[model samples]
Target: MHDDRFQLPADADERTLLTCFLDWHRKALVRTCAGLPDEQLRRRAVPTSNLTLLGLVRHLAGVERWYFQGGIAENYPGSLYTATGKLGEDFDDLDSATGEASFAIWRAEVETSRRITAERPLEALSTHVITGQSLSLRWVLNHMIDEYARHNGHADLIREAIDGQVGE
Candidate 1:
């Protein structure tokens, strides 16, 4: 409910608005994980779900890599958390994964994503390796906004479950 500095502005252009929203969503997830102990941060806070703050952090890090480096840049630097032929590895092993490492990777990936996008125009296209489909930076930004928005909602519930603290 409290308005933070990360909130997207209503008057911005398409590019500015999209980037701000994505950033707001990113910070929302991080805010949810802030101040919690490593154990609680990594706990499966949702019922019948493998979702955890730490895992979300790792998952987002991989997402950053997949979208920016793998998808946009087409660099294929490899996944951050999941190994080859593995699935959901980011959201797995919550008990042993530490928040510090996860945050470090997540933050770094975000920085890289920002750089990649800043250097390109919204109409710039990138190919998807699996589907051989071309996608524009516009599409990537929209997708990232939606992706982080959904995940941040889950993070909100989990954080509320862990502690009484709650906000956008």
Candidate 2:
């Protein structure tokens, strides 16, 4: 908790620091999604956008899958949701029953990503799908830290709009 290097300790090694961010991001993600009503989860804060808290949950799950499963493992389990831009389309209004499923998928992706990261060496190189270029596991993990942190910020705004909830 005392660490300040992007949620990590200044004394920690590069790998450990990156791991800290990864851990922070996963926890932050869950916190952002917690305790929201179905109606609020589906409500779009922006007047001209399709983004909603529930959709963000699904989107981040997909983001984890595509990055770790598809890009890292080279075998993604397909997508749980498509690129739909309709409000309330994500998880069919984020009701309690369906919210459980959404949480399940998000939880699964977190576990999968953790396993992948732990099993692979930090210096190990893998092919990047979008660029067809190679990058070390270290690089991707660092990038994911950035990715999750950015999305969590977006999530903060959306969650705040839902009921004025704020902070982790």
Candidate 3:
């Protein structure tokens, strides 16, 4: 497999390090779903959790939009997945989800996020979606890293259970 997460430099600045780690985790989610069919991608391996690789992709796309566009960029074009007021629709509507479309949406959102934050200072603040409070870019980056890491852990288990494929 072609891994993009291993290209991190040993001596890098804080933003570089954080963004590299975020990119690594981003690709980790993609890496975990590689070669799997759409049906397999939508499989909820864990009986207790409704999370699927496809769902994660859709969820993350919405999250990327929520934080970057809605929160940080203040674009507020509404959520990509939860626009119907159906919370958790990303995971709930997996039977009709297509892996290719989900991945494309996610990739586009990630690109948009990068563009939005690239020139912004870490201390620059944006209003929160729910709280109407100021949120710094630093907090957003940290939260995104944490979100991806947490979901990627679930993805690891799901992928392994799907075909026994495993790695960081």
Highest lDDT model number: 3
Model 2, runs deviating above 4 Å: 1-9, 83-97, 128-131
Global lDDT of each candidate: 0.83, 0.74, 0.86
Worst 10 residues of 3 by lDDT: 1-10
- Candidate 3, residue 113: Cα displacement in angstroms equals 0.3
> Stretches of candidate 3 above 4 Å error?
1-11, 84-87
For model 1, name the residue pairs that clash.
Answer: none
TM-score, candidate number 1: 0.90
User: Candidate 3 on 1-168: residue-level lDDT in tens?
Assistant: 654545666677778877888888898898888999999999989888888888889999988888888888877777787757766787887777888989999999999999988969888899966658788888989999999999998888889999998635
> Per-residue lDDT for 70-102 in model 1, tens only?
888878688777776467778886777788888
The residue-level lDDT of candidate 3 at 25 comes to 87
Q: Model 2 over residues 1-168: C-alpha lDDT tens digits?
A: 333446455587877777777878877877777887667767777767777777777877877887777777777676667647553354443445355677788888889988998889898777756546676778778888888888788888888887888548
> If ranked by lDDT, best first, what sequence of candidates would result?
3, 1, 2
